[model samples]
Target: MNQADIVIVGAGAAGLMAARELSKEGKKVLILEARGRIGGRIYPLPKEEWGYEAQGGAEFVHGEAPVSKALLKEAGATLTHPTEWWSVRDGPPSKIERLSPHDLQLEEALKKLTGDTTVAQFLDSNFPAGEHDDLRNFVQSWVEGYDAADIHKASALTLRDEMLDQGSWRQMCIREGYGLLLKYLQDACMQNGVEILLHKAVTAITVNQNGVSIQCSDGLIYQTKRVVVTVPLPVLQTLQFTPPLPKKTQAAAKIGFGGVIKIIIRFKTKWWTGPREQPFERLFFMLSKEPVPTWWTQHPEPHTTLTGWLPGPNAEHVKNHSDEEILTLALLSLSRIFNISIEQLREELATFKIVNWIKDPFARGAYSYSTPESKEAVQELHRPVDNKLYFAGEAICEEDANGTAEAALASGLRVAKEIRESF
Candidate 1:
């Protein structure tokens, strides 16, 4: 048994941020991570030569969050911003149908939910035949990858409110690996004197009037004045809390997080049919499609790679499918869109791989989302217990910027400040 001023469970963005902040203020902080790696979901796939190119966790830098950008810059991580001009692969490059007026209406209606209904309810009432309707399917697909969830289970109001109006920064990907960014954050924490312990899964948390006691799988107990939990929302659903979580927290956990399964495919050559100036970098949104509602390609980077995403229920289905099956689905989708032969794609693509987050025990799901019904759920999760056990993560974010690494960091820092003030 050991004691510290603060204990953080799950060394993801939130935990690391909290530890870094508290440690800098001279608080003894210990971060216990279940996985061998420090970054919870932020682990990089081996290179192209390895089995496949998959991102275990995050892929995008997502907007211009100063906290994330500053951390990356401080760590000397390479970042490249896109130019003003960007193209959307609307129709097949050859036959470009004007962006439809009908589609625009639907888009606007859905976007208005930023302050209104749960995504499920909105789609149910608005879509004539409901969310599964073919017409609404397109919108569902394009948006799924954003939250890594199906539209039916998402929250429209949460999405819209958190939607970064910072126009130009909407679409961007990390030039390197998103995992690299996590590594940088971890390094920053270490430099600030935070101690990170890997493979130490926090199995139990017992809190009393005085403080909190955390128990790991290895039978080690850690005592601390305060505990900050940053595990994914879904993971919390399965955890056994002492004295049982309050009725509200239990219900909030039942809300459950949406699932996202992303497939990253690498090609040997640039086999895009679109013009060089028009190289396919758009979301490649299949507006009304179901299952794999959306897919897209990032220009020829280190390797000509096309990353496809399946969010929500479809993402769950993809996770159940084998790697070869996922690869087949991706190739079939690409062939149909670009009018390319399967043989052509096969020849151009050297290898393809899938990253199944659903199978990942640490991150049962990608990120947390606040459904119209679950809006208050997140706030409930953030409520501290006896000022000893606090929470921070995408699920507990108290802002429109919910379910993002930046939000996670922001939430963690806020909790750290609260603890500092109390001390």
Candidate 2:
């Protein structure tokens, strides 16, 4: 049987970070990743394919991501900020208003919330139905599209905290792509003698007094003093524990795992910033009521590409659709938004790729969101069972950065500290 001091399941940001930290303390660390490649949801597309390093998965560095920022800096990656934001209803695209009267009222109501509840309940109680329909719709879209959360289950208090933290509306993109940062972490772990085995999907974990035995799908059993599971909540739910961690698995189910369908379309030219009646020269983001409600450009970087974001329930709606069907939907949405012909879009299209995280076997969903019960659920998961089975991931992070890379990195660091303290 293979042996190590600690074995980490999933080589994503959390697992990689944990391995690096534990290896620094002279611990024998082994990281097993189900996927052939590392970086989990942080999939960076080939630079040559799109003339730039386009992202296939996680993109923006939302708000003040201290952990992500520090890692980017260490990786020697440059950060670029998007310039403009626009929205469209029927006519031409226009600049998005930062705050409306309804938004102000919603903000005030959110501040008065004393207890945790679902976003849907909060909206119904405060905003009501008829007069506040716009506000309700906006809130629903924001919750579903931006946070990739379901309004009926997503925590209102958590959303409020996230909104307050994002009051500055600061977002940054890495010039070299997030892959560079992951490479840095992977390299650091390797240099510290942390062994990372790819395509080793962990099937069952048996914990005993002396140590723990991890069984992979390939029939390899690894004996380790401890195991850190950093997979997504959905994947975690499917993992088997020998002693049966009913509470941990049950808690994992309580945490909301959201889906996302990201569509990247590369064009032959920057047609959006063209000699049309109203040019989208400074178009950074565009929102509409189309099937794919959100779209954005690689603004400030002169890239001729538009990324379509269909998240949460919207993505789930088309989860079973084929790639061709999804691509057609994306094109149709863009055509309607730009008042351009679908044929013209086809002609201008250079290359395209669709990323359906909902269908990804290892991921199952994009990331985690907070439910009213998520705080307690996350707490339960954080407490290691028998001091042998520990959990660390974005879902385990019971903070404002629950859905971002920062959260994953922070959780990894926290678990590493916990393991070291135990030793």
Candidate 3:
């Protein structure tokens, strides 16, 4: 039997951050992870004698969250800001670099969309209920692009409320691998006296007046006074609790994490000739009418290599297919616009990898969102019940929701504070 002051499941951003916070207060914290390595979704790819290749999750410190920025500085991680970054596909990639009033208007619209009502509802109501189909379609495209999901299937209310206020600067990528940052976090946790146990898949959690008992797949029992659950929402749903969660909690879990798939293609040399017909740092847009609508390119890392993105239903469709089939389809899709060939992909493309978070057991899905009928579901998911169990992750963050490393870290710290207040 293992015992600790607080037991954290999942060694990803939320879990690590929670553990770090608790440990800072001198609490004995232990983190159990199913995967052998840390950084649940945030990971680096294989080294083919090139530069930093990212397989799983890879993104830089985003947003103005003090916690995330402070952690980066605490770890001595240096960042390289790209001069030209993030271009949307709707138009010619609006280059209003200095955070203009137009961007703020869009921000207000986003806030109005996500906060009081669903994005779909907000768009519908904003345009006389029957007008502006073209405008609505454009707005939907932008929303889908953000989540890597289709607008119809995602939660409009959740999207409108929680994600709208996050500014444009919230999106950024790391120069090195995202996994490297995870390694730095691991080292920092160790220095802070936090214990991280890998290959520990928590199966069941029982909470009573005494405390919480976590049952693992390996038949190991961990007893602790408090537990912080940082696992993704989908995985949380699959887990069984002794007394069964409340109806609201169950409903919240059913909201489901948005499905996302990222296909990374590393080229021997830069093959893309910039989207704007001009040289820039980052390029993003809807490639075609295919399932994988959006694709983007970033400069080479250490070695000369280019990485592209394929998200949303396009990702779900290709998730189960073979590597060859996926590679073929992706190249074919890109070839349509780029005027490239499959032979070029076979020749110049050094390597390619696919990441489908929905298929991963550790992360059943990417993150959770608010649905049209269930804006309150997200709140239920994050609320800690009985003072014995707490939840933390990108999905549960109240303010800074959506797909950002900062959101995940903020969630961890939030839950840790909850535990501190409870005790």
Task: Give the distance in Å from residue 250's predicted Cα in candidate 2 to where it truly belongs.
Answer: 1.2
Q: What local distance difference test score does each model get? A: 0.68, 0.89, 0.67
Candidate 2's TM-score: 0.97
The better-scoring model by lDDT among 1 and 3 is 1
Error of 3 at 272 (Å): 2.5
Best by lDDT: 2
Q: How much is 34 displaced in model 3, in angstroms?
A: 1.0
lDDT (10s digit) by residue, model 2, range 234-325? 98888889899899999999988899999999999988888876768988889898999889999888899999999999899999999999
lDDT of 1 by residue, 223-327 (tens): 889888888877776666796886546756645477777777777765663464344543233332323445554533434666676666677766778888877
Residue-wise C-alpha lDDT for candidate 3, range 1-423, written one tens digit per residue: 246899999999888888877888778899999999888878677655445545556565555656666776666665655444433434443443532223444456665543454455566656534566655655565555556556655665545433554454455555555665677777767888899889999999999888999999999899999888877777877788888986635665545456676677777866665453645444333334444555655543434354445565556666788767766777776665555677876788877776767688888666555555344666776667777888887767766454567778888888988888877
* Whole-model lDDT, model 3: 0.67
- Count of clashing residue pairs in every prediction: 7, 0, 10
User: Looking at candidate 2, what is the lDDT of residue 10?
Assistant: 95
The parts of candidate 3 lying over 4 Å away from their true place are: 47-50, 53-55, 83-115, 123-133, 153-166, 254-256, 273-291, 300-303, 372-375
RMSD of 3: 3.9
Q: Identify the superior model by lDDT, candidate 2 or candidate 3.
A: 2
Output the lDDT of residue 333, model 1. Answer: 72
